[model samples]
Target chain A: AQSVAQPEDQVNVAEGNPLTVKCTYSVSGNPYLFWYVQYPNRGLQFLLKYITGDNLVKGSYGFEAEFNKSQTSFHLKKPSALVSDSALYFCAVTSGAGSYQLTFGKGTKLSVIP
Target chain B: DTAVSQTPKYLVTQMGNDKSIKCEQNLGHDTMYWYKQDSKKFLKIMFSYNNKELIINETVPNRFSPKSPDKAHLNLHINSLELGDSAVYFCASSQTTGGSQPQHFGDGTRLSIL
Candidate 1:
Protein backbone atom coordinates (compact mmCIF):
# COMPACT_ATOMS: atom_id res chain seq x y z
CA ALA A 1 0.00 0.00 0.00
CA GLN A 2 1.17 3.54 -0.78
CA SER A 3 1.41 5.75 2.28
CA VAL A 4 2.71 9.18 3.22
CA ALA A 5 4.06 10.30 6.57
CA GLN A 6 4.48 13.82 7.83
CA PRO A 7 6.82 13.60 10.77
CA GLU A 8 5.98 16.91 12.41
CA ASP A 9 2.56 17.76 13.75
CA GLN A 10 3.37 21.46 13.79
CA VAL A 11 6.17 23.76 12.65
CA ASN A 12 6.78 27.24 14.05
CA VAL A 13 8.77 29.84 12.18
CA ALA A 14 9.26 33.59 12.52
CA GLU A 15 8.29 35.93 9.73
CA GLY A 16 10.94 36.38 7.02
CA ASN A 17 12.72 33.23 8.17
CA PRO A 18 13.04 30.12 6.11
CA LEU A 19 10.57 27.30 6.78
CA THR A 20 10.46 23.60 6.04
CA VAL A 21 7.83 20.88 6.33
CA LYS A 22 9.03 17.28 6.26
CA CYS A 23 7.37 14.50 4.31
CA THR A 24 8.24 10.89 3.56
CA TYR A 25 6.58 8.20 1.52
CA SER A 26 6.54 4.47 0.85
CA VAL A 27 5.31 3.10 -2.43
CA SER A 28 5.75 -0.04 -4.52
CA GLY A 29 6.71 1.59 -7.81
CA ASN A 30 7.47 5.11 -8.92
CA PRO A 31 5.64 7.73 -6.86
CA TYR A 32 3.94 10.93 -7.97
CA LEU A 33 4.18 13.27 -5.03
CA PHE A 34 2.35 16.52 -4.49
CA TRP A 35 2.10 19.32 -1.93
CA TYR A 36 -1.09 21.09 -0.97
CA VAL A 37 -2.01 23.90 1.42
CA GLN A 38 -5.26 24.38 3.28
CA TYR A 39 -6.36 27.53 5.04
CA PRO A 40 -8.83 27.67 7.87
CA ASN A 41 -12.26 26.42 6.82
CA ARG A 42 -11.04 25.98 3.25
CA GLY A 43 -10.29 23.01 1.06
CA LEU A 44 -6.83 22.11 -0.05
CA GLN A 45 -5.09 24.23 -2.65
CA PHE A 46 -2.57 22.61 -4.97
CA LEU A 47 0.96 23.87 -4.50
CA LEU A 48 3.23 21.71 -6.61
CA LYS A 49 3.77 18.17 -7.86
CA TYR A 50 6.77 16.02 -8.72
CA ILE A 51 5.78 13.56 -11.43
CA THR A 52 8.96 13.02 -13.46
CA GLY A 53 10.94 16.19 -13.24
CA ASP A 54 13.95 17.94 -11.80
CA ASN A 55 14.84 17.44 -8.15
CA LEU A 56 13.81 21.00 -7.27
CA VAL A 57 10.23 21.78 -8.23
CA LYS A 58 8.95 25.35 -7.85
CA GLY A 59 5.37 26.02 -6.91
CA SER A 60 2.90 28.76 -6.06
CA TYR A 61 3.51 31.60 -3.59
CA GLY A 62 7.30 31.39 -3.74
CA PHE A 63 7.27 27.77 -2.56
CA GLU A 64 9.47 24.91 -3.69
CA ALA A 65 10.10 21.32 -2.80
CA GLU A 66 13.12 19.07 -3.00
CA PHE A 67 12.49 15.51 -4.08
CA ASN A 68 15.13 13.34 -2.47
CA LYS A 69 14.74 9.97 -4.09
CA SER A 70 17.34 8.29 -1.92
CA GLN A 71 15.66 9.56 1.21
CA THR A 72 12.15 8.91 -0.11
CA SER A 73 11.29 12.41 1.00
CA PHE A 74 9.74 15.53 -0.53
CA HIS A 75 10.06 18.43 1.84
CA LEU A 76 8.31 21.73 1.15
CA LYS A 77 10.43 24.81 1.59
CA LYS A 78 10.26 28.56 1.35
CA PRO A 79 13.09 31.05 1.38
CA SER A 80 11.11 33.48 3.51
CA ALA A 81 7.93 32.96 5.45
CA LEU A 82 5.06 35.37 5.87
CA VAL A 83 2.52 35.56 8.63
CA SER A 84 -0.24 34.73 6.16
CA ASP A 85 1.54 31.55 5.18
CA SER A 86 0.40 29.86 8.36
CA ALA A 87 -1.85 27.00 7.37
CA LEU A 88 -2.06 23.22 7.16
CA TYR A 89 0.22 21.50 4.71
CA PHE A 90 -0.35 18.04 3.32
CA CYS A 91 1.91 15.77 1.38
CA ALA A 92 0.33 13.21 -0.90
CA VAL A 93 1.59 10.36 -3.05
CA THR A 94 0.13 7.97 -5.56
CA SER A 95 1.39 5.07 -7.63
CA GLY A 96 2.31 6.34 -11.08
CA ALA A 97 0.12 3.93 -13.00
CA GLY A 98 -1.92 2.17 -10.36
CA SER A 99 -4.55 4.29 -8.64
CA TYR A 100 -5.94 7.69 -9.50
CA GLN A 101 -6.44 8.62 -5.86
CA LEU A 102 -3.80 10.22 -3.68
CA THR A 103 -2.83 8.98 -0.23
CA PHE A 104 -2.38 12.01 1.99
CA GLY A 105 -0.40 12.37 5.17
CA LYS A 106 -1.55 13.70 8.50
CA GLY A 107 -1.18 17.41 7.82
CA THR A 108 1.54 19.58 9.32
CA LYS A 109 0.30 22.82 10.78
CA LEU A 110 2.58 25.76 10.05
CA SER A 111 2.55 28.74 12.38
CA VAL A 112 4.33 31.82 11.09
CA ILE A 113 4.74 34.30 13.89
CA PRO A 114 5.23 37.90 13.05
CA ASP B 1 -14.99 31.68 -12.39
CA THR B 2 -14.61 28.97 -9.83
CA ALA B 3 -12.90 25.87 -11.16
CA VAL B 4 -14.65 23.52 -8.79
CA SER B 5 -17.60 24.17 -6.43
CA GLN B 6 -19.62 22.26 -3.84
CA THR B 7 -23.06 23.21 -2.59
CA PRO B 8 -24.11 23.70 1.05
CA LYS B 9 -20.84 24.93 2.41
CA TYR B 10 -22.21 24.32 5.92
CA LEU B 11 -24.64 21.53 6.70
CA VAL B 12 -26.11 20.89 10.16
CA THR B 13 -28.39 17.92 10.42
CA GLN B 14 -29.73 15.48 12.98
CA MET B 15 -28.80 11.81 13.22
CA GLY B 16 -30.72 9.33 11.04
CA ASN B 17 -31.55 12.08 8.57
CA ASP B 18 -30.50 11.88 4.94
CA LYS B 19 -28.55 14.59 3.14
CA SER B 20 -26.76 15.19 -0.12
CA ILE B 21 -23.79 17.29 -1.16
CA LYS B 22 -23.57 18.42 -4.75
CA CYS B 23 -20.34 19.08 -6.64
CA GLU B 24 -19.46 20.44 -10.05
CA GLN B 25 -16.34 21.25 -11.97
CA ASN B 26 -16.05 23.69 -14.84
CA LEU B 27 -12.45 22.92 -15.67
CA GLY B 28 -13.61 20.35 -18.18
CA HIS B 29 -11.54 17.71 -16.43
CA ASP B 30 -12.30 14.09 -17.09
CA THR B 31 -12.00 12.91 -13.52
CA MET B 32 -13.70 13.99 -10.29
CA TYR B 33 -13.24 12.83 -6.71
CA TRP B 34 -14.62 13.13 -3.20
CA TYR B 35 -12.42 13.44 -0.15
CA LYS B 36 -13.15 13.60 3.57
CA GLN B 37 -11.02 15.48 6.10
CA ASP B 38 -11.28 14.86 9.79
CA SER B 39 -10.67 17.39 12.55
CA LYS B 40 -7.05 16.40 12.78
CA LYS B 41 -6.75 17.22 9.07
CA PHE B 42 -6.26 13.66 7.88
CA LEU B 43 -7.61 13.41 4.36
CA LYS B 44 -8.98 10.24 2.76
CA ILE B 45 -10.37 9.65 -0.68
CA MET B 46 -13.90 8.32 -0.59
CA PHE B 47 -14.84 7.98 -4.24
CA SER B 48 -13.84 8.97 -7.75
CA TYR B 49 -15.50 9.07 -11.15
CA ASN B 50 -13.84 9.17 -14.54
CA ASN B 51 -15.95 10.18 -17.49
CA LYS B 52 -19.08 9.50 -15.50
CA GLU B 53 -17.92 5.98 -14.65
CA LEU B 54 -17.06 4.70 -11.23
CA ILE B 55 -13.32 4.29 -11.36
CA ILE B 56 -12.36 4.15 -7.69
CA ASN B 57 -14.40 3.50 -4.56
CA GLU B 58 -12.70 3.40 -1.19
CA THR B 59 -13.75 1.29 1.82
CA VAL B 60 -16.49 3.75 2.69
CA PRO B 61 -19.79 2.62 4.11
CA ASN B 62 -22.62 1.79 1.73
CA ARG B 63 -24.62 4.59 3.33
CA PHE B 64 -22.36 7.05 1.57
CA SER B 65 -23.19 6.71 -2.11
CA PRO B 66 -21.63 8.90 -4.78
CA LYS B 67 -23.48 9.61 -7.98
CA SER B 68 -21.93 11.11 -11.06
CA PRO B 69 -24.55 12.41 -13.42
CA ASP B 70 -22.00 13.67 -15.92
CA LYS B 71 -18.28 13.94 -16.30
CA ALA B 72 -18.35 17.45 -14.87
CA HIS B 73 -20.65 16.77 -11.93
CA LEU B 74 -20.50 14.36 -9.01
CA ASN B 75 -22.84 14.29 -6.05
CA LEU B 76 -22.68 12.46 -2.73
CA HIS B 77 -25.80 11.23 -0.95
CA ILE B 78 -25.71 9.83 2.54
CA ASN B 79 -28.52 7.54 3.60
CA SER B 80 -28.29 7.74 7.39
CA LEU B 81 -26.27 10.54 8.84
CA GLU B 82 -24.14 9.50 11.82
CA LEU B 83 -22.28 11.55 14.36
CA GLY B 84 -19.09 10.14 12.92
CA ASP B 85 -20.02 11.65 9.58
CA SER B 86 -19.41 15.16 10.84
CA ALA B 87 -16.42 16.36 8.90
CA VAL B 88 -15.37 18.51 5.99
CA TYR B 89 -16.05 17.02 2.56
CA PHE B 90 -14.14 18.24 -0.45
CA CYS B 91 -14.68 17.90 -4.20
CA ALA B 92 -11.71 17.74 -6.51
CA SER B 93 -10.95 17.23 -10.20
CA SER B 94 -7.99 16.63 -12.44
CA GLN B 95 -7.31 16.17 -16.10
CA THR B 96 -6.16 12.61 -16.62
CA THR B 97 -5.28 11.92 -20.24
CA GLY B 98 -2.76 9.16 -19.60
CA GLY B 99 -1.10 10.07 -16.33
CA SER B 100 -2.74 11.75 -13.38
CA GLN B 101 -2.26 15.44 -12.71
CA PRO B 102 -2.49 17.78 -9.74
CA GLN B 103 -6.09 17.97 -8.54
CA HIS B 104 -7.97 21.24 -8.04
CA PHE B 105 -10.20 21.26 -4.98
CA GLY B 106 -13.26 23.19 -3.96
CA ASP B 107 -13.88 25.13 -0.74
CA GLY B 108 -15.20 22.00 1.04
CA THR B 109 -18.50 21.52 2.85
CA ARG B 110 -18.49 21.43 6.63
CA LEU B 111 -21.07 18.88 7.75
CA SER B 112 -22.13 18.87 11.37
CA ILE B 113 -24.22 16.02 12.74
CA LEU B 114 -26.34 16.75 15.78
Candidate 2:
Protein backbone atom coordinates (compact mmCIF):
# COMPACT_ATOMS: atom_id res chain seq x y z
CA ALA A 1 0.00 0.00 0.00
CA GLN A 2 1.08 3.58 -0.70
CA SER A 3 0.45 6.61 1.47
CA VAL A 4 1.25 10.35 1.44
CA ALA A 5 1.42 12.99 4.12
CA GLN A 6 0.94 16.76 4.04
CA PRO A 7 1.66 17.90 7.56
CA GLU A 8 0.31 21.40 7.32
CA ASP A 9 -3.44 21.84 7.15
CA GLN A 10 -2.97 25.44 6.02
CA VAL A 11 -0.05 27.48 4.73
CA ASN A 12 0.04 31.27 4.77
CA VAL A 13 2.40 33.27 2.55
CA ALA A 14 2.79 36.85 1.47
CA GLU A 15 2.60 37.99 -2.10
CA GLY A 16 5.95 38.03 -3.93
CA ASN A 17 7.41 35.77 -1.27
CA PRO A 18 8.46 32.22 -1.92
CA LEU A 19 6.12 29.52 -0.70
CA THR A 20 6.53 25.85 -0.03
CA VAL A 21 3.97 23.10 0.63
CA LYS A 22 5.69 20.07 2.06
CA CYS A 23 4.77 16.47 1.24
CA THR A 24 6.13 13.03 2.14
CA TYR A 25 5.34 9.55 0.89
CA SER A 26 5.78 5.87 1.72
CA VAL A 27 5.64 3.03 -0.77
CA SER A 28 7.04 -0.42 -1.22
CA GLY A 29 9.23 0.49 -4.19
CA ASN A 30 10.27 3.58 -6.07
CA PRO A 31 7.38 6.02 -5.75
CA TYR A 32 5.78 8.22 -8.35
CA LEU A 33 5.11 11.59 -6.74
CA PHE A 34 2.69 14.27 -7.89
CA TRP A 35 1.29 17.64 -6.84
CA TYR A 36 -2.18 18.84 -7.71
CA VAL A 37 -4.01 22.08 -7.01
CA GLN A 38 -7.72 22.65 -6.62
CA TYR A 39 -9.25 26.05 -6.96
CA PRO A 40 -12.52 27.14 -5.38
CA ASN A 41 -15.34 24.95 -6.68
CA ARG A 42 -13.05 23.52 -9.34
CA GLY A 43 -11.38 20.27 -10.12
CA LEU A 44 -7.83 19.32 -9.32
CA GLN A 45 -5.20 20.47 -11.79
CA PHE A 46 -1.93 18.65 -12.24
CA LEU A 47 1.03 20.74 -11.19
CA LEU A 48 4.18 18.63 -11.27
CA LYS A 49 5.41 15.08 -11.10
CA TYR A 50 8.64 13.30 -10.25
CA ILE A 51 9.06 10.11 -12.24
CA THR A 52 12.80 9.60 -12.71
CA GLY A 53 16.14 11.32 -13.26
CA ASP A 54 15.66 15.02 -12.58
CA ASN A 55 15.10 15.53 -8.90
CA LEU A 56 13.77 19.02 -9.57
CA VAL A 57 10.70 18.86 -11.79
CA LYS A 58 9.04 21.99 -13.15
CA GLY A 59 5.34 22.10 -13.78
CA SER A 60 2.59 24.41 -15.01
CA TYR A 61 2.04 28.00 -13.81
CA GLY A 62 5.59 28.65 -12.67
CA PHE A 63 5.42 25.93 -10.00
CA GLU A 64 8.10 23.35 -9.29
CA ALA A 65 8.86 20.51 -6.89
CA GLU A 66 11.96 18.78 -5.63
CA PHE A 67 12.14 15.05 -5.10
CA ASN A 68 14.32 14.08 -2.17
CA LYS A 69 14.77 10.36 -1.88
CA SER A 70 16.76 10.53 1.33
CA GLN A 71 14.08 12.61 2.98
CA THR A 72 11.25 10.81 1.19
CA SER A 73 9.79 14.22 0.42
CA PHE A 74 8.43 16.03 -2.61
CA HIS A 75 7.76 19.64 -1.64
CA LEU A 76 6.01 22.07 -3.99
CA LYS A 77 7.65 25.47 -4.32
CA LYS A 78 7.21 28.78 -6.07
CA PRO A 79 9.65 31.67 -6.23
CA SER A 80 6.90 34.27 -6.08
CA ALA A 81 3.59 33.70 -4.47
CA LEU A 82 0.45 35.03 -6.05
CA VAL A 83 -2.90 35.53 -4.42
CA SER A 84 -4.43 33.58 -7.25
CA ASP A 85 -2.23 30.66 -6.35
CA SER A 86 -4.05 30.22 -3.06
CA ALA A 87 -5.87 26.94 -3.17
CA LEU A 88 -5.96 23.40 -1.83
CA TYR A 89 -2.77 21.55 -2.65
CA PHE A 90 -2.57 17.78 -2.56
CA CYS A 91 0.38 15.42 -2.78
CA ALA A 92 -0.07 11.94 -4.16
CA VAL A 93 2.00 8.77 -4.42
CA THR A 94 1.72 5.49 -6.27
CA SER A 95 4.03 2.52 -6.55
CA GLY A 96 5.91 1.66 -9.73
CA ALA A 97 4.23 -1.72 -10.29
CA GLY A 98 1.38 -3.99 -9.17
CA SER A 99 -1.00 -1.39 -7.77
CA TYR A 100 -2.72 1.22 -9.89
CA GLN A 101 -4.23 3.39 -7.18
CA LEU A 102 -2.70 6.73 -6.20
CA THR A 103 -2.78 7.41 -2.49
CA PHE A 104 -3.44 11.09 -1.89
CA GLY A 105 -2.55 13.16 1.11
CA LYS A 106 -4.86 15.32 3.13
CA GLY A 107 -4.85 18.60 1.24
CA THR A 108 -2.96 21.68 2.40
CA LYS A 109 -4.88 24.89 1.96
CA LEU A 110 -2.60 27.64 0.68
CA SER A 111 -3.51 31.24 1.40
CA VAL A 112 -1.42 33.88 -0.33
CA ILE A 113 -2.22 36.99 1.60
CA PRO A 114 -1.78 40.33 -0.03
CA ASP B 1 -12.09 21.00 -25.07
CA THR B 2 -12.36 19.71 -21.56
CA ALA B 3 -9.91 16.91 -20.88
CA VAL B 4 -12.15 15.39 -18.21
CA SER B 5 -15.75 16.19 -17.39
CA GLN B 6 -18.48 14.88 -15.06
CA THR B 7 -22.17 15.55 -15.21
CA PRO B 8 -24.66 16.91 -12.63
CA LYS B 9 -22.13 19.13 -10.96
CA TYR B 10 -24.56 19.26 -8.06
CA LEU B 11 -26.66 16.35 -6.78
CA VAL B 12 -29.16 16.58 -3.96
CA THR B 13 -31.22 13.68 -2.74
CA GLN B 14 -32.71 12.01 0.31
CA MET B 15 -31.56 8.96 2.20
CA GLY B 16 -32.11 5.54 0.64
CA ASN B 17 -32.23 7.07 -2.82
CA ASP B 18 -30.27 5.86 -5.81
CA LYS B 19 -28.27 8.04 -8.15
CA SER B 20 -25.50 7.94 -10.67
CA ILE B 21 -22.72 10.23 -11.76
CA LYS B 22 -21.35 10.13 -15.28
CA CYS B 23 -17.79 10.89 -16.34
CA GLU B 24 -16.09 11.35 -19.70
CA GLN B 25 -12.53 12.06 -20.69
CA ASN B 26 -11.42 13.33 -24.06
CA LEU B 27 -7.70 13.05 -23.36
CA GLY B 28 -7.66 9.49 -24.68
CA HIS B 29 -6.37 8.16 -21.39
CA ASP B 30 -6.39 4.43 -20.70
CA THR B 31 -7.19 4.54 -16.98
CA MET B 32 -10.00 6.27 -15.09
CA TYR B 33 -10.72 6.67 -11.41
CA TRP B 34 -13.37 7.66 -8.86
CA TYR B 35 -12.61 9.66 -5.74
CA LYS B 36 -14.54 11.09 -2.83
CA GLN B 37 -13.73 14.32 -0.99
CA ASP B 38 -15.52 14.43 2.30
CA SER B 39 -16.47 17.42 4.44
CA LYS B 40 -13.02 17.26 6.00
CA LYS B 41 -11.55 17.59 2.50
CA PHE B 42 -9.70 14.29 2.54
CA LEU B 43 -9.56 12.74 -0.91
CA LYS B 44 -10.03 8.98 -0.98
CA ILE B 45 -9.99 6.60 -3.90
CA MET B 46 -13.16 4.64 -4.52
CA PHE B 47 -12.47 2.65 -7.64
CA SER B 48 -10.33 2.50 -10.79
CA TYR B 49 -10.74 1.09 -14.26
CA ASN B 50 -8.23 0.41 -16.99
CA ASN B 51 -9.48 -0.18 -20.50
CA LYS B 52 -13.01 -0.91 -19.30
CA GLU B 53 -11.76 -3.46 -16.77
CA LEU B 54 -12.06 -2.97 -13.04
CA ILE B 55 -8.55 -2.72 -11.64
CA ILE B 56 -8.52 -0.96 -8.27
CA ASN B 57 -11.43 -1.45 -5.96
CA GLU B 58 -10.66 0.24 -2.69
CA THR B 59 -12.35 -0.59 0.64
CA VAL B 60 -15.44 1.25 -0.53
CA PRO B 61 -18.81 -0.17 0.40
CA ASN B 62 -20.67 -2.42 -1.99
CA ARG B 63 -23.35 0.23 -2.26
CA PHE B 64 -20.97 2.03 -4.59
CA SER B 65 -20.51 0.56 -8.05
CA PRO B 66 -18.32 1.63 -10.95
CA LYS B 67 -18.84 0.95 -14.62
CA SER B 68 -16.55 1.67 -17.51
CA PRO B 69 -18.38 1.18 -20.73
CA ASP B 70 -15.39 2.41 -22.73
CA LYS B 71 -11.93 3.74 -22.16
CA ALA B 72 -13.13 7.31 -22.53
CA HIS B 73 -15.94 7.01 -20.02
CA LEU B 74 -16.33 5.76 -16.44
CA ASN B 75 -19.42 6.18 -14.30
CA LEU B 76 -20.29 5.80 -10.61
CA HIS B 77 -23.55 4.46 -9.25
CA ILE B 78 -24.66 4.75 -5.66
CA ASN B 79 -27.36 2.64 -4.14
CA SER B 80 -29.14 3.39 -0.85
CA LEU B 81 -27.29 6.59 -0.31
CA GLU B 82 -26.69 7.64 3.26
CA LEU B 83 -25.95 10.96 4.90
CA GLY B 84 -22.37 9.86 5.22
CA ASP B 85 -22.23 9.65 1.44
CA SER B 86 -22.68 13.39 1.12
CA ALA B 87 -19.48 14.62 -0.44
CA VAL B 88 -17.83 15.69 -3.64
CA TYR B 89 -17.29 12.89 -6.10
CA PHE B 90 -14.54 13.47 -8.62
CA CYS B 91 -13.66 11.57 -11.77
CA ALA B 92 -10.20 11.47 -13.26
CA SER B 93 -8.26 9.81 -16.05
CA SER B 94 -4.65 9.12 -16.92
CA GLN B 95 -2.72 8.10 -19.98
CA THR B 96 -1.41 4.98 -18.29
CA THR B 97 -1.62 3.23 -14.97
CA GLY B 98 2.13 3.08 -14.41
CA GLY B 99 4.83 5.71 -14.10
CA SER B 100 4.21 9.33 -13.14
CA GLN B 101 1.46 9.97 -15.59
CA PRO B 102 -0.54 12.79 -14.01
CA GLN B 103 -4.27 12.13 -13.74
CA HIS B 104 -6.58 14.83 -15.06
CA PHE B 105 -9.67 15.54 -12.91
CA GLY B 106 -13.18 16.81 -13.37
CA ASP B 107 -14.94 19.63 -11.52
CA GLY B 108 -16.60 17.03 -9.26
CA THR B 109 -20.22 16.39 -8.34
CA ARG B 110 -21.28 17.69 -4.99
CA LEU B 111 -23.75 15.16 -3.59
CA SER B 112 -25.79 16.52 -0.72
CA ILE B 113 -27.83 13.84 1.00
CA LEU B 114 -30.39 15.28 3.30
Q: Which ten residues in a row have the lowest lDDT in candidate 2 chain B?
A: B94-103
lDDT of 1 by residue, B1-114 (tens): 999999999999999999999999999999999999988878999998999999889999999999999999999999899999999999999997333488999999999999
Candidate 1: regions farther than 4 A off = B97-99
- Looking at model 1, the pairs that clash are none
> Could you report the DockQ of all the candidates, in the order they appear?
0.65, 0.75
Give the alpha carbon lDDT tens digit for every residue of B1-114 in model 2: 888999999999999999999999999899999999999889998989999999889899999999999999999999999999999999999898875688999999999999
lDDT of 2 at B33: 93
Q: Tens digit of lDDT per residue, candidate 1, span A22-46?
A: 9999998899999999999888999
- Candidate RMSDs in Å, in order, are 1.1, 1.0
Candidate that scores best on DockQ: 2
Off by over 4 Å in 2: none
